[model samples]
Target: MGLAVGAGAAGLAIGGGAGIAGGVALGRARERRTADAVASGDGIHQPGITTPVQDHLHFAAFDMMARTTRDDVASLLQDWTYAANRMMQGLEVSATGAVGGSPEAPPDDTGEALGLPASNLTITFGFGPSLFDERFGLAAQRPAGLERLPAFLGDDLDPERSDGDLCIQACADDPQVAVHAIRNLSRIAFGRARIRWSQLGFGRTSKTTSDQATPRNLFGFKDGTANILADDAAALDENVWVSASEGPAWLAGGSYLVARRIAMLIETWDRVRLSEQDRIVGRDKARGAPLSGGDEFTAPDFAATDGSGTPRIDARSHVRLAHPDQNGGIRILRRGYNFVDGNTDLGRLNAGLFFLSFQRSPDRYITVQRALATDAMAEYIRHVGSGLWAVPPAPAAGQSIGAGLLGA
Candidate 1:
């Protein structure tokens, strides 16, 4: 479970202390000038989820066209795998790229990322429940834990943005690099599949590596303070990754991904009192310390109470319900992002967290989400769009993505 060593534009060494700031600045400069850099063969096709999370994200879900056959879908995944392998190394989708193609034909690559580095670009693919339907003849191959997620209490889901037959998550340190990955993949799909909905996210809402500083959500509170880190190999294997004995063989090394688009009621939250805000989240806004705690990582003293005899961490507080203690020790790897898509019809800022989590089974999320159904924070946030996807493991050399599931 040691970290894999790789050589590519994304493989810049991140130093610590004062060097951290310098390292980031230098990394950005290198990214800008790495367009022509040749990538080493190592770590080119590693699974993105296991790799450190990137700074920006472009996540999209697509549905297959009605006339598209199962074989067509399989071929699309194979083509996507080939293209993704090159893109991750700062190369074009094909040998004859954007400007090298014939004048009468469209270029193989979309030129948006022409001069950009890989920027740690990682494109992960997943299959939705709908993909295993009758159209694909894949129902019997579906994993036992890959069923559709149940509706929660406060959900106000938008149908168009909810479910999909397939999903692709492209993340990178550079925003344009992430966008370009998705754009070309969608282009490659062409008539076989079309985008159902997509989300663009800037600053990360959670940190996956120990070296990274905790990022803040749109709610202005530090998010994922107790999140599972990539270095926690034991926890990752037990909670995040699906084992061969856990379910269907096709999904042995896979994981379930749950995405919830939680929209914050910004105007209303802005007007709320600071103390009330702290009470709602059960943590100090400035320090991220628990109400009955010592520091940011201090375990909450849920049993401690004030002289008034009330629980220090309120029963309905978010931290209390979402805590692993309350959810049978279940934890999911959160890799969320903060998003703002202009103003709403009422002219208020439309902003919130694009909450994403990966787990061995969807039940981990379902259990915790049901617990938070009555959380005080639910009053300030609305669950708008949602999706559950079964993410397959990374492909080996000479294999296509999801080769096991598609029998490729």
Candidate 2:
């Protein structure tokens, strides 16, 4: 599909006799509604939140520049809303696109994805707790559930990559599509925001839909075996999406996202025996069956014993502690991806899972993470970065993203 006409053009077309001010307002409203509809899944494009987990991810976090005003931030969001709508539909950022603009000035779009398919690209935006501080006059509107997460045991978080004022999660079947989205968005925010840290990931480790096969992590185990499926509306309402009555009207349909950069001790883990690995994970590496002897989807028999009368699933095994049964039946939607950045200074692979989960509240993650503090697998992984973001709901046909919170 072609890129939507610019608001200025739309205004000029209809403003011939009506005057610029009124026509501009009417044109913007019309263009916004069109953009919102396209993003809301009226066609092939899907909004990021509901979009199926793709093969690649370009996750970025940014801090607002010191001189950017609240109004500037709002304008940026509006621009992003329009640009994202076009990109998701496989079009350029603007009508002039990457190469059609004036020769003297830089192009509006970077053009890396010029001939690529939409590739099921989705761009999701989020707000961090710091954004609601005194800087933007948004403190009063901050959701009670959007608090900063407390440091967890065994967390080796890097200050530079931990938190940010804003976040954008771009996912696509093709890596270039995902990268292009972030690249153009960053360019758009030139004077307003600077990327704090970013991570590129591949090999999704979770299944958001039943049609997809369960994927594996670097540890060679089927991950997210008991994940919350997108088809389960009730489960999502109960665990993933935040409701209006929950508090903070602006965040009624929003969700909280927690991201962790976990670096695996691959060399150490690789040398472990197969049986030992199964015991540590509480599941067979190949079959992904519970150690108690059932299929991948079979309910784990945490109480079962072995031939020697020992607990089949170790008391401190990764699964036992992370299981919902042990954590008040709390479940978060996992959409993690495997990452291999490069080799560490010591010649070890600097690679692991980029853990991403969405839940109704931060407490959901906090509770489960704390329970995993004593997990046997903790020794094989170290958390080097973390972030918490409040992901607002998709825009309606006439609304901009976070319109309720920003009051734009």
List model 1 lDDT by residue over 1-408, tens digit each.
111111254433221100000000011111111122122232222345656778889999999998888888877777776666567766677766788767777777888988888787777888999999999889998887787789999999999888899999888888998899899989888878999999998889887788888888877899999989877879988899889898887677678999999999999999999989989999989999999969998999899899999888899999999999999999999988889999999999999989899999999999999999889999999999999999876544455667777875
Error of 1 at 139 (Å): 0.8
User: What is the TM-score of candidate 2?
Assistant: 0.90
Model 2 vs truth, CA RMSD: 6.7
State the lDDT of candidate 2 residue by residue for 1-408, as single tens digits.
Answer: 111211211211111111101000112122332343431122211144434678999999999999788887786777677777667667787777788877777777888988787777767788999999998899998888787789989999998988899999888888998999999888878788989999999999998778889999999999989998866879988998888898687777778899999999999999999999999999999989999887999999999997899999999999999999999999999989999999999999999999999899999999999999999999899999999999876555445567778766
What shift in Å separates residue 361 of candidate 1 from its native position after superposition? 0.4
lDDT of 2 at 358: 89
Candidates' TM-scores? 0.90, 0.90
Please list the residue runs of candidate 1 whose C-alpha ends up more than 4 Å from where it truly belongs after superposition: 1-46
Candidate 2 lDDT score at position 345: 98
Q: What's the lDDT for residue 376 in model 2?
A: 95
